[model samples]
Target: MTKLTLGVSSCLLGDEVRFNGGHKHHRWLTHTFGQYADFVPYCPEVAIGMGIPRNPIRLISTDTGTRAVDSMNLTDDYTERLQHYAESIVPQLDALDGYVVMQGSPSCGMERVKLYNKNMIPEKIAAGLYTGVLQRHAPAIPFEESGRLSDPNLVENFVQRVYVYHDWRTRQPWRTAKELIDFHARQKYLLMMHDYPTYKRLGQKLSNLKDIDNRGAFGQAYLVELMAALSNIPKRGHRVNVLQHVMGYFKNQLSEKEKASLIHSIEQYQASEVPFIVPVALLKHYIFLHGDQFPYLMNQTFLNPYPEELGLRNPI
Candidate 1:
């Protein structure tokens, strides 16, 4: 696979572009995941002419909506400038599979940034001005805050979505009905694990290709819904359900003892006694040995969503 290209906050990449002339420097992004991806850093604050060591900005709730303004001097608003900068980069952002944003930043935070009211008190939480515009313009792209990557489940989910989106982007599957259906087939189990209802719904939608009037519109809408479904972190029960479904395929292949061991591993994972990777690894072993007999199971993305070397599923 080609290396993924990710849009990242400049500060998170160790660039001293912060208001305080410092950096948020995320080590895992720079060292580990960086091995599989090339970072395209953007510092909206700096991009909009806010020099290093400039006064910090914060989100303020105005009568119209949220505004980015100088924290100390709220009169100096930068909302329009930040929004314009994000808008101008729409073409550049299209090349990225995902984005890692700085949390609590007025310019780049993806979510839960403080939104202060007139009395200088934080009244609510919202996305930063820059990221808000970008998300609106391209809702299909996977966006995760740097702070949220600390959770193993979120990390795994984010990376999975990145790979799926990248594949779709590069392959342009929607060009033909067969190509689109084939792509969906590969993602069936992964989608089922995240959202079973959506999984079934999307399949039904794709069942009748002749009904699609505009392939481009249908494909874009399909991807948007698919990404939204994938955004839901699969509950342990949901994962167990998918695991059992996959195990069903090997009913005749595995001996009684082997089947019992696989069952035990799944049971341990379901009960939270072990990490999810343990059972998944066992299933992969069986799939490797018996893949020729069950080609469908071998192509499922749920079995290998991202590169195993990342070990993203270990903690969850």
Candidate 2:
């Protein structure tokens, strides 16, 4: 297994590194991920030499591109320095598989960041300082926000993307069309759950590529399409939908008595509004108490999303 090294905003880990010395610590993250991956904590404000409890900055739209201006004034542009520092540090962060940033911050928010006008008026232009640069530098990395992590779907997809990214990197000297095909197949269910049309279009793109003589160029194009194929899939809601279908497999395997207890809980899944893991866990407790009737429930879709061997229960 390729251990994913994830970078996160230091403030989101309850670190008192925010501009006002407050943190946006997400408990679900620090508790669950703290044990799984290597977290490289970063505070961009401090990294750019701005200390804690310093003046705040917001994104501004001048005649030029979006600029980071002092929230208190419209004259000063602090983003040139942030841009320079980002270009330098982005190269050194070559090993990260994913990043989780604090949303709505001018410096780190991934999207919908506040953009201001020259008149010091807030506009709806969404932009983030470090986020755009980091994404441009590492296009393949999985990135999301602290708030978005609460949705189990985004968490599952983020985890899958991180693992896949690491897996792609490990297949050094990626050779043969079959390798590309297998990777794409593995992502099939994820694509279906997210964007059905985009998923369909990506399949066409992959199928109709021009035959080139050079193998290296073809492989490079393959990798690009692999990322492009996944691009349309919205990372959040689709992931949850996939998880719920996977949970359904457990329901089908239950005995008459066990099924009776879980049928109502399982029915809630039809609305697709509640968390699948919640009801799935209830079913597991009801069945596992029997101790041997459905021992393989541990290996069921409710338990593992990605298995070494394909189970008919898996959605993809």
TM-score of each: 0.96, 0.69
Model 2 lDDT on a 0 to 1 scale:
0.66
Q: Could you say which candidate leads in TM-score?
A: 1
| Cα distance off (Å), candidate 2, residue 45 | 1.5
**Tens digit per residue, CA lDDT, model 2, 1-316:** 5456888989988999988989988886777666567788888788888878887988987687888877777576778888877787686556776788998889888888878776767865574888888878766667888877766555665665666666665664546655555555556555665566665766676565444435466655655555554545354355455545544545565677766656655556545545555554665575566535544444332244432231212121
Give all candidates' CA lDDT scores. 0.90, 0.66
Candidate 1 lDDT score relative to the true structure: 0.90
Q: What clash count goes with each model?
A: 0, 0
Give the clashing pairs for model 1. Answer: none
Q: Which stretches of candidate 2 lie over 4 Å from their true place?
A: 197-316
Residues 39-115, model 1: lDDT tens digits = 99999888889889999998888898888888889899998899889999988977899999998887888888898
